[model samples]
Target: MEWNAPGEWTPAAAAEPGQPRKGILLIHGLGDSPWTFVDIAAELSKRGYLVRTILLPGHGTRPEDVMYVTADDWRQVVRQQADAMRRDVDTLYLGGFSTGANLALEYAYDHADVAGLVLFSPGFKSLSLDWLAPALAVT
Candidate 1:
């Protein structure tokens, strides 16, 4: 999948004029990029929805960058995208996977105007990195 660099943002595929939008903002998991949601976005677009995926801070370019970013950085990016979408569409939806889901939840909390949320493998709290030390060491 093609990846977007940090600080780079892309607009959602446009819908036909007068077509009511099902606006969706898709967030990628840790170490992943907006490209992760290409399939999902395509499917949503086919279903008459305007789907946009965002690359969170320090993601999509290098894994090392992700290690340097704080959770708040991620939250800010999601919030900015959500706010932009809210201004353009009639109904808004947020969705993501893993840590991305957490960011989505945080966005929803701040933006209660969203119509709905769709989470995949949502995380209520952080996962224990210590538990995966063995696997991480090998990688």
Candidate 2:
């Protein structure tokens, strides 16, 4: 679990004492670990963003841990982490990969204060073969 553990990155101090800080909370997808965001977190940190990555409930541990996890479990973790991050930064962003992206979307829907979202490979729904009609027509 060493490599899969959650991590955080802090940006350099603000130029002015009263300047507001910007932060992002990244959630890893199902069957994935926080390591998925290591590179991106480093890049964002370099760009003056306070970045954090969380180990989703039932993740970063035994594979059996996910058996009892539910969507509500993940949602609660996201809500708690977001609230905590908001306390330290003036602007907050949520980012996610795969299933995590779906969770982020749901959170943003009810929380208007979220500054923005960065989603990658969102897992909103299963891909439909029906959408292939246009691509088949081109060929």
Candidate 3:
């Protein structure tokens, strides 16, 4: 029922019950699922982190789901989960790949409570259609 599912955010197994919680929320890119971070989450878990990944709405499902999805959909998911995690963990981090990184960046900007951010292949520049390029372009 946990991570064996394609898109579930399974907590790391090594975390203790009462320690100062350090949690990481991992997000996958377009057309991908939480499964993308399985190995990384497991490794982080082994290192004593509470690792959770989320299935952005319209993801881990049929391709048609993406066609109807919007930026608000992605933002809403990250916002809600990050907000919830902040209450549950002493330290909360957001890590993502590609478009997921874009969502994480925006969420981190708006939510300063986040402890740190881990991004891979962040794609906001290309996906933003040059709108965010002037200010956010990594290059």
Candidate 4:
């Protein structure tokens, strides 16, 4: 659906006369689109937050588009979006799901000004060796 495309919501300044403006940039998972955060963004806006969701490189189009997409590409987009979001609000935060969660964590790690992170099932740790954990532990 067209509504699934990237989205941004900025609450009216009148919503909180003297409250500090807060913003959050959300990222979608490897095979997901900005749609993932649509509902969440709306809810955050109702609470006076400036919310944004962006399509990672190679996303919001054909699946094959991601075939050659690199982690660097994703990092670049997240960095840009976060930077822009920072400019729009007084406090900045990041959030994501799955692969997106990993990217958010990476960016926040180096950007201390980021207020916090809202991660959903971050995919950073490798589970490939988990299946062998039992056997190795027994040794």
Top-scoring candidate (TM-score): 2
Q: Clash pairs of candidate 2?
A: none
lDDT of 2 by residue, 14-131 (tens): 4558767999999999999999999999999888889999988888788878867888999999999999999989999999999889999999999999999999999677768858
**Better candidate number, 2 or 4, judged by lDDT:** 2
Q: In model 1, which range of ten residues has the least summed lDDT?
A: 5-14
* Worst ten in a row by lDDT for model 4: 130-139
Please list the C-alpha lDDT of all candidates, in the order they appear: 0.76, 0.90, 0.78, 0.87
Q: How many Å off is the CA of 6 in candidate 3? A: 6.5
Ranking by TM-score: 2, 4, 3, 1
Number of the top candidate by lDDT? Answer: 2
Q: What TM value does model 3 have?
A: 0.79
The RMSD of every model to the true structure, in order and in angstroms, is 4.5, 7.4, 6.3, 6.4
lDDT of 3 by residue, 1-139 (tens): 4432433234554255666777888888888878889888888777767777888888766777776778898898888887777777789899999988888988889878788999999975554466765576333
Error of 1 at 117 (Å): 1.0
- Separate clash counts for every candidate: 0, 0, 0, 0
Residue 6 C-alpha lDDT in model 2: 89
What are the TM-scores, per candidate, against the unseen true structure?
Answer: 0.78, 0.86, 0.79, 0.85
Q: Can you write out model 1's per-residue Cα lDDT over 11-74, one digit (the tens) per residue?
A: 3444356656668889989877777777777778766677788888887666677767788888
Q: Give the TM-score of candidate 1.
A: 0.78
